[model samples]
Target: MSKQKRNTHSPELKAKVALEAVRGLKTANEIAQEFGVHPVQVGQWKKALLADSASLFDKKRGPKPKPEYQSDEKLYGEIGRLKMELDWLKKKSGINLP
Candidate 1:
């Protein structure tokens, strides 16, 4: 028999329950039974909370923001490398421009 998945809670409610489960006020099994959800889901929430707690200590809170990459130095390095390649190509192809 195929099992049906039922998402009975909203995102806000899920987060609330997960946070409550992570807080250890009640066991995951208890929360799962109360919420009519699987214990595995509550366990997953607890695991996620514990794994991510260290990053939450900063001034920023909530979900961690995606890191901003591509520094100016990397851009400059790429430009220089491309310029060198262009110069080499021009010399090899004997291309003269106005």
Candidate 2:
């Protein structure tokens, strides 16, 4: 028995077909035939594009906000290391910092 692999279209091709459908320049059946896909597939892609089109403009146009990933324990460890180095330098110089 021979197994047949399913056809997977690239994102670019799907976008092209969906855009054509949205433009009303071609019917779903015509777009599907031209794109070598099923009519149902063309309709699905068009619906998905239309549904998600609003999100394209909904995003803010600026640099993304960075996440605060620093932990309190990590910060405390850095402070402790700096304090130890300062104390060592003071002892070596024979200078008291009270």
Candidate 3:
């Protein structure tokens, strides 16, 4: 027996199905049958949409906060230290560099 390839649905189609599920106008089985997807998938999408909807309005307007651990001075110092170690190793190994 040959294995059947799984079908991939587009984001738009998923949104439509989820929206329909949220509206409660039709049952999950009906929505799944109409959209050619499993009822579980429809329920999952609806749950995800509802969960993320709050974050849509919670976003703050302005530049995002910078991370605490990142600094240009620290990065440059690390690079210089690495270069010195590499040079020391090369000289000790008698590897000539032009």
Candidate 4:
């Protein structure tokens, strides 16, 4: 038996096919045939498109806030702790660091 190559569809094509299916003018089988994909796949795409459609407009209009790694006070405290540790180590080793 010969192996059949799988077909890969682009996002644009998926959106087009799913939109056509959503229109309900033609059945899933017809859309699948036209797009050379399975009817179930067409249905799934339609469902996904409908489900995610709401999220398309759910985004708020504004500049997104930047992520903060740590607060300024916390970073300064850590730096102070590190300096204290370094000074103790230098004093213990009799190495005077100016």
Per-residue lDDT for 31-52 in model 4, tens only?
Answer: 9999899999999999999999
The list of candidate 3 runs beyond 4 A from truth reads 72-98
Identify the leading candidate in terms of TM-score: 4
Q: Each candidate's lDDT (Cα)? A: 0.80, 0.92, 0.93, 0.94
Pairs of residues at least 3 apart in sequence or in different chains that clash in candidate 3: none
lDDT of 1 by residue, 8-69 (tens): 66767677778989778998888988888898988877687778778788566578665456
Cα deviation of 20, candidate 2, in Å: 0.9
Query: Using Cα atoms with residue i matched to residue i, what is each candidate's TM-score against the true structure?
Result: 0.48, 0.62, 0.66, 0.66
Better of 2 and 3 by lDDT: 3
Better of 2 and 4 by TM-score: 4
User: Which stretches in model 2 have alpha-carbon errors above 4 Å?
Assistant: 65-98
TM-score of 4: 0.66
Which tens-of-lDDT digit does each residue in 6-57 have in candidate 3? 9998989989999999999999999999999999999999999999989999
Between the candidate structures 1 and 3, which one is better when assessed by lDDT?
3
Q: Please give the distance, in angstroms, between residue 10's alpha carbon in candidate 2 and its true position after superposition.
A: 0.9
When superposed on Cα atoms, how far off is each prediction in RMSD? 6.0, 4.5, 5.6, 4.2
Ranking by lDDT: 4, 3, 2, 1
